[model samples]
Target: MEMVAAAATKDAKRNGGTPEWRVTVPEGASVTVEHERCLAARAWGWLVSCVVALGAKVSGSGKRLWKIGADDPRRAVHGLKVGLALSLVSVFYYTRPLYEGVGGNAMWAIMTVVVVFEYTVGGCVYKGFNRAAATVSAGAIALGVHWVAVHAGGELEPFIRSGSVFLLASIATFSRFIPTVKARFDYGVTIFILTYSLVAVSGYRVEALLVMAQSRVCTIAIGIFMCLAVCVLVCPVWAGQELHRLTARNMDKLAGAVEACVKDYFADQPADGKQPPSDKAEGYKCVLNSKASEDSQANLARWEPAHGRFGFRHPYEQYKSVGAAMRHCAYCVEALSGCARSEIQAPHHIKQRLAGGCASVAARCALALREASSSVAAMKTSWALDLAVAEMNTAVQELQSDLRSLPSKLVEEESPAAVLDAVQLFTVTSLLIEVSTRIESVVDAVDTLASLAGFRSSDVEKDEASETETKVKQPAASDPDSYEPEKKHIEQV
Candidate 1:
């Protein structure tokens, strides 16, 4: 076949194209080069399909194999890598003359590859190391127990060997409940049970117990190595990087939510606007939904090794505090929404002032949130977050003063319905103060995250001049709407 191909290539070069093909017949067996090449290609194609099928089945990707689209590329890459790794291990075993029968039944190695391969490289590495450690520890223990049972004499040997399985099972089961073991070596217990059963129970029948044990361990190790190599070396997907981006996206969503909520909250306050109560509460959903996304990515990021600039799972740990801050912000929004639900009539002149103040503060807070989001996305310090915190504090103080200047007490001695308007105004003031206070922590949370992600002070550093700048931006104290536009409108005895 090689000679025929070479001769055909030479003819094609000389004549500018291939001459008419002729097949040399072997009497009754008409075997042609073309037929041989076609058969070879078909066999190769069939082998690939079979391997892919087996790999998909083993790695649990069989169910998702047909989900081929933008969302399914990760699975496809994982399955392809798994199939390739399995084939490589098989090749090493089959081609080596000395491996002959030793490599023929390397199911242990195959199983290791199948079980350790995960979507993320970090997950694969973690599982691979855990599996290898468990297999070795369990195999060693099994071999030791088998030796002890063997020397226990002919009469008691069977009993001791049988009891060893139960004993090992009990220990393995109990050890798995330990916090440290459950956290790190949970899989090891399962491995201990299987390894011990195989070595102790099957050792009696199989005289080559030691050889079987050695082969099993070797195959498992090979499988783990192959899986780790492919998962790490081939276009690896990182959980930490994904988490960072997800958090940033969520922050952006939160900004939009706040912007919308504030716009609705203050709309048409005897001014020019028309928004429903439901519209005011819509922003809270984004903040609430953000919690779930933040949680999932944080958990996955924990499994990821120290990635990029993050130190050994540092980025994952910060999520707890950051998530807490976000939850607090969500609660504030909920409270504000509650206030928005109640219709509150205040002095007509002061209504515009209150609404304007809240709208301005909300806009500032949203801007800060957006800046924090960008800082997290960029993995740098955000002085803008700190600036937002100060603005919220100032707003809270202003709201408190406004609350104190209101006429009739919200906790009225008069008819409850008579002071309903005062109570509503009080509720709005209190909710606004709470929202401002809660928003103050968001910048700190984001800043802490930035530091943990390894962004230094020099990188997007903050300035103390923001306080002076914020004061400058504050509404003048003598303005008609300043502090108490309704001071003269207060109903007195």
Candidate 2:
């Protein structure tokens, strides 16, 4: 085997390919890889080849070939071949010529097809034939309950036996849960079937017992092997892959929302001194959209990407974490939008009165303008918004981490409060971060406008000085005569 492998490696290298393939026996190992893996390799390879050949002959006729028991058809075929061999042996030893025309023929035919189909598609191979066994077990229980009620001379007492039958059925149905409790739950299903069959055949005569027991065992056992063979033959599609894709898609959407926020904040706009009427509205709308978009992503994460056979039992925790992050992003948008909108327009009179240094352009053109002092006020508002936006972003990242931890940390018996606490922390953290960033942006915009208008914090000092000088020059008119004359003169005029 080593020589053959070496020769193959040389041929592969000669054909302009790297020697990527090799065969080796591990140290202290009694079994060879060839013995353990040979059946699988041969079966899968042959099946693929057969399918290709069949497709070539049929010209697209085999596009939607029937999928047998999560297994490749070839594996299922192998199982059927084995089953047929066993059936022939059993028939030869267990049957008489006189009884051949009775129920045996029909039972074998039905059992064969069912067993083959179940094994091929039900994922019975990788795990065990639990589902098939569970169903059969439930059926057997129902039959037993019926028999017990009849034997008790309470044939009309369907109610008495109904409880046991239904309970067994429910147990069988939920046997999927047993896999969680114990990795090998298939044995439970088998035991359940056997027990139920034993109960149902308890009062039956020998002939009836033989027929029913033989049929039930044959169907269940055959089904189990057939499903295993089927799964082995197929490529074994993973449920986890679909879950991951869904998780990624949701995360991408969340990322897109963040990108949109960046673009909206940094995008260039008309540089005219006059603020556009729609500017505030557009900014606010973008903030709202960002919030909603983030929320959706978070929801997608929590629900997980549901697909495949085992998805119901699989908890997708990562998706939930992404969602928490998105919420933080939304909170940040809110803070930013709120700060941007809180800015008060400066009074036009202030612009008109301070004509030379601050409001000169507005006064000259008779244009609407903000009060000079209001510019400084707006700056402070923007600063607050910016701070909030920054905080919200930080919170989102934190919350995402917390959410990611949930799937691994959460236990079946854990208190709901624990989960809620984690979620709330992430949410609150994101909200604070968002609020900080938004405040910062608003502050920045306000400050820029203030600077552009020559309304700096230092300007307040200048205004105070000018006010002092004017007060010193002004004097109170203490003369009543002067005031009386001014009033009389105004009246006469």
Candidate 3:
């Protein structure tokens, strides 16, 4: 009798329909009613038939697969077919009692068919069972409360109040235990809550209520399993993997852009103080803008999945860094353009041009054009740009070293310092130092930009500028035009 009562209690929590308990309550000798009113036999039967009919109607209709003009139409059709089949099977099992006895071999066959279908379709065997477990637990708890109320001669209102409080508390308490049930059984928590909510509102015998709940739960499990089975047996879609691939592809494109920008910088005369036309700087600016824009998009695309799937914070710093680096490159290109124009327009009488000097400048400018246009087309190629930038910095340092080896006068003449007064020279030198500081800062920014685009930096360091001055070769010392005729005449050859 105790075992029978316990089984009845368990069945009630499941929202089982029409349970027959041996022990009768004081208020009622026996009770028979549907458990889950929402999906009782009448409603379940219609819903199942409707789903099957819909599936049959659209069996080979390509429209079902390509609901939207997206990829993989077959997967959708497969899901529909499996879902329809599962629904039909579930309806058959639930409605079996209409034609046959409830506790007979027919009910057992229905349960077996439903469970087998669920396991085969669904990937996670244990998680699939949580829904059923929750319904059963809820129904059992509700039934126990009702039995106690009737046995103690309590009113329906008190019974409901007690049942609601217990169900809510049970869900909360059992949530801790659900995690331990299986790795994928996290959804079990929701199943019980939903089942209890439905049962409490419907006044019925525990057995009847559990039967209805079980039927509903079986149907749900079938649907879920069908979807899973179709996806696994056919070509499954993985959002995480797709998102990751998209991010990687965009990064590659951005890397290409970076390479193009870097190569262009080196080839462009304006960037490194060589010159061609006045419009070159403007052209370079446009290229930089386009590449920067592309890189921005790629960077955002990389973060989309991270933020969407895992709730990671959006990378605003990367966007700002790329923007700032592009701007700095623009400024450098403009400055180089101005220097190149100065070299070109200088009076030929003042100094003879060195062999191939003009051609070298032109070649540099041409290289920049080609790189910006072809080799490095996207910011994704940041690694190549980083290498180029490092090379440029090295070349600049070498040039500075060569300039220092000459006399102090030569240093003043070679740099912008030649035109400045003593105070101005000091000020200009300080300004140059400040500018150099900015140059290094821009280099670091470039490195960071490359890193964000998934590139590594080489082990090259820009040694700090020395405070001590080096000797320089003065141009005036060797200039025939600047020689005093009397002094040279006295020392006649």
- lDDT, candidates in the order shown: 0.69, 0.43, 0.44
Give the least accurate 10-residue stretch of model 1, judged by summed lDDT. 271-280
Write the candidate numbers in order of decreasing lDDT: 1, 3, 2
Top candidate when judged by lDDT against the true structure: 1
| Pick by lDDT: 2 or 3, better one | 3
- TM-score-wise, the better of 1 and 3 is 1
Question: In candidate 2, what residue range of length 10 has the lowest lDDT sum?
Answer: 361-370
lDDT of each residue in 141-230, candidate 1, tens digit only: 777877887798778878988887888799889999998777566766787687778777887888887888788887888888888788
My TM-score estimates for the predictions, one after another, are 0.66, 0.30, 0.34
Top-down TM-score ranking: 1, 3, 2
For residues 1-493, what per-residue lDDT tens digits would candidate 2 score against the true structure?
7787888888888988766565666754645655668878999999999999987978654443444434455555655655554554345236676235344533543353343332223223323344455546555555656556666775544455555646664766577566443434544565565456444445243336545555555544544554445444544333344333433343233333333333322223334423333342233233334434443333232322334322443433333343344344445544433322323322223212221211121121111111211333332222333343344445445545654555346444455555543443334334434433433333344345444433335456667899999977765477466477679989999
Q: Residue 166 lDDT in model 3?
A: 72
Score residue 443 of candidate 2 by CA lDDT: 36
Clashes of each: 0, 52, 51
